[model samples]
Target chain A: MKEFQYKNPTRATWAEDYSFLNNDLDNSKLEGDKNKKSNLKVTDLNLYIHQHHILKNVSLEIPDNKITCIIGPSGCGKSTLLKTFNRLIDDTEGIRYDGSIWVDDVDIFDKKTEITDIRKKMGLLSQRPCPLPMSIYDNITFGCKLHGIRNKKRLAEIVEEQLKAVGLWEEVKDRLHAPASKLSIGQQQRLCLARGLAVEPEFILADEATSALDPISSKHIEELFVELKKDYAIILVTHTLRQALRIADHVIFMYLGKVIEAGPADEIFNNPKEELTRKYLEGAFS
Target chain B: MNRILKNKIAAGMMFSLTLASISLVVLIGMGLYLKSAPIFKEHSLWELISSADWQPSSGKFGFLPFIGGTLWITGIAVILALPVALLTSIFLSEHSKPYVKKWIFPALDILAGIPSVVYGVWGILLVVPWVSEVLAPHFVEYATGYSTLSGGIVLGVMILPLLISLFVEIFAAVPRDLRDAALSLGATRWQTSKLVILRKTLPGLLAAVMLAISRAFGETIAVLMVCGNIPLLPHSLFDSCYPLPALIANNYGEMLSVPMYESALMLAAFFLFIVVLIFNTSSRAVIYKLERKFQ
Candidate 1:
């Protein structure tokens, strides 16, 4: 419960260090400039979930190798926006969308985006830890098998490497055959993180990945995210302002399905811009 | 009485009821063993188990043929029923809508409630003639009213609804999370069913099948009507057969010789008791295995 402010570096501090903030506030201009370079972009994105227009004309550049944190209040369409990237929301009953989500220079919604390959490129983690009722080794190696990586030796190596990467290798090395759910909640969450990362995805989307864990677990996940961002660009949706401030390199503040504020994490947290963003940071409304 | 005394009284009542039921079961078992001690002494366990001759009048009472017939019929019934029942269960659990499930499930319950006598009568009147006239020409060439296949098939139908409904309940009890989790892992719908859902609920499904088999094993009237009550080993589906229950029912009325009759009946009952007991114990063991696995 702390009050935080995000300065619109585009509006203020238009100096040498903050020159990147001069991109247009509207998404169309931002996308045109960014998409000519990167492979993924949200172009004039609008997401209407059921009767509620969850995201209204929201767009952002999800750069190839940079972490983007979607920070917002509950039900602000942060997770909804992330789900749209992989067309997961399409599985739901009554979702209607009118926008373009392009991945790897191809419009993903263009009737040609194979969900399997799209999902292969982008691994996802939910808020709760979901290690399948399988062995620790198998849980980590499951997605690899799905992508047709059947070489057992290679799978064993990937399991070891991913577990080590998530800092869970030492704790579970000897008991790789043990059921993944037998681990503590913290360990289970890390196990799930390892599962996602084992797929070797270029982009990892975590929807409040550590929200259901204890503070210690949350801290470990945050550290893992920082380490992970070095390799895979992360799109994390979190309600925790402190979490966003701690790890997010770039922050997009969403409210009522709209981007209330967007800027670098440091500028967004330390300075003032939108009143809704400020109030949200101050714990005015969760 | 104080609260503690009241609680103790309640506990004691439950303990007494449990004690009574267990005692009754033990007494019945003991009584059967004691009553059949003459047969066990005269005929060795191997003779009782392996001998095929079932002539009780001259005291050459080998219950093996009846036991074998019982087993073969039950096995055939289960083999026939299991696939049909399992497929029905899967359809009900996975494919049927809520309204269809609600109505279809109760229809299955009504099938369960239909008496064995009705099934027996139906098997004789409706099923027997159909098999003789329609199915016999291509296969048996001289089909009779009583055959193992007819008995087993009718018995299978009788137990099919029970097995299907129990299977549906078992499969339905599988957690939605297990399905969703597998699906989200990029597994196709069929893969999810085959891998996660089926694997998780295998123990329950196994228990259901075992119970159905147990029911099929002990069923009497239906088997009696269709089994063409010959005491000989059936070579094919068209041959006459005699399962234990049919034998017991056949001989019980005209069995005037005391020791011969008593011993035959006791041996048959003993055989059934052992079979049912084994099935029940295995069912419990499966449940225990499932619990331990989850734990």
Candidate 2:
């Protein structure tokens, strides 16, 4: 059965679509040739969730088009830090934060900077594979359709491109109209990735995105992040230090809501560093 | 007793209890069918249901007027209640503060706990006059204080809390992650709710609505008090109509002297029983399928 049909959004509607999918991302095929160098500059950001100081005064710079891995134990505000970039935490009740995350001089926290615009620039993959309750083809095009890509042929092309991008087309091609929740966990995660990619976000924020998958699926995602680092600035929050070591270009070590160490992956993993970082690497408290 | 043997005994006990309940439903259905058999034997079932001539002395029992009235009131109740109930439940489930829900749920519970007789009295005291004096004047030429419009209004109010409670539960059961996925894709809050959460909960919402319809269909006292019991072919909202529940409730106790009348009433009960049975069972099946799918 045909599960999803587009209502041919007019050009005016497309113009007013959520940030219009950033036109430059359409032609961003070459490596190191991205139009904008949007490095997130988090300056002394303090967060309080339900009056609990969840994130201490945290400051860091996330480089453009690189895999930045946030490594820490559970409840260390790694996911919290990741959420602040897109202002997803604003939806949380009793959450108050004073953070100026400048995305290339445009502060995300600024009232003038539309929150949807800031969010459209970044993709999020949460801990679980959450397919929007629709068919496989619909799930992949869910974000794209919202950005007003109404041409049926173009939508089909996008669904094919994204599904193939995450290497899921061959597996799911025959059943495009099937419910996405029917897919296996690994396939569902890849579908989520493809859905996010359809939005053409410059940054991919993955919060333990592979923790729920099998080792093979976990490996598959790890390989994808390394490949996707060329086109998107990939931010990964991982509890597994080995995963951080394997794919991170830059590593951020956080302990109890504070960044204990931040540097190149090799430098942070191999060399002498902060005592807390070393002890964390040594499995002192987990 | 040995622990495993004790566990076996407990399991056997629970299974038997469940079986008994299942069989009891079957038994009730069979009993109604059998009791209503005499009337169907006397006249073809379709002939009896489709004919509007419901004269008792001449052995002519056409039940179309009562069925039409039942459908009319229920249609009104659904149309009035569904939109408001669905919207309020969505608000309660998604947008309202927990404290707001805390007071509202209890208030709804109290509304639900109030007896049907009280609702009928309230309809008689307020809604009937309001329909005749306030609402009907703008639309129709003539309308009695007691009419299908009043019955519908009362039945709609009676089912609102029931519908809202079920709808809220359905919406609340949807995973928060679905909403998270939508918003993360830069969708607006309304878009996320409508496209993702609402779509996911659509089946459950429909099942709840069907359950509400069955409840409205069989509601006797409230509908009877408001609906004028003049078993005529209902032409408009303001026309007096006699629903099946009202017919059986109005005549069953006093008219047992006429065996044919008793048989006719039994058939009406059978019709309601079968219709409600289909609604409840089918809705339950839909809910069960939804549960398995999400799980």
Candidate 1 residue runs with Cα over 4 Å from true position: A1-114, A250-275, A284-286, B95-100, B121-141, B250-258, B286-295
lDDT of 1 by residue, A27-63 (tens): 4455676333334678778877568888999877764
lDDT of 2 by residue, A1-286 (tens): 1222222211122223312133435333454553765567799999998879999989988866678899988999999999998988776878888967887678988888987777888899989999887889998888888888888899999999998989999999999988898999999999999999999998999999999999999999988987887788899999998787677777899999999888666666665289888768766223
The candidate maximizing lDDT is 2
Highest-scoring model, TM-score: 2
Residue B257 of model 1, lDDT score: 62
Q: Tens digit of lDDT per residue, candidate 1, span B78-111?
A: 9999999877887777766567887987898899
Task: Give the C-alpha lDDT of model 2.
Answer: 0.85
Candidate 1: fraction of native contacts reproduced = 0.14
Q: Which candidate has the highest DockQ of all?
A: 2
- Which residue ranges in model 2 land beyond 4 Å of their true spot? A1-34, A284-286, B284-295
Local distance difference test values of all predictions, in order: 0.78, 0.85
* Model 1 TM: 0.81
Model 2: which residue pairs collide?
none
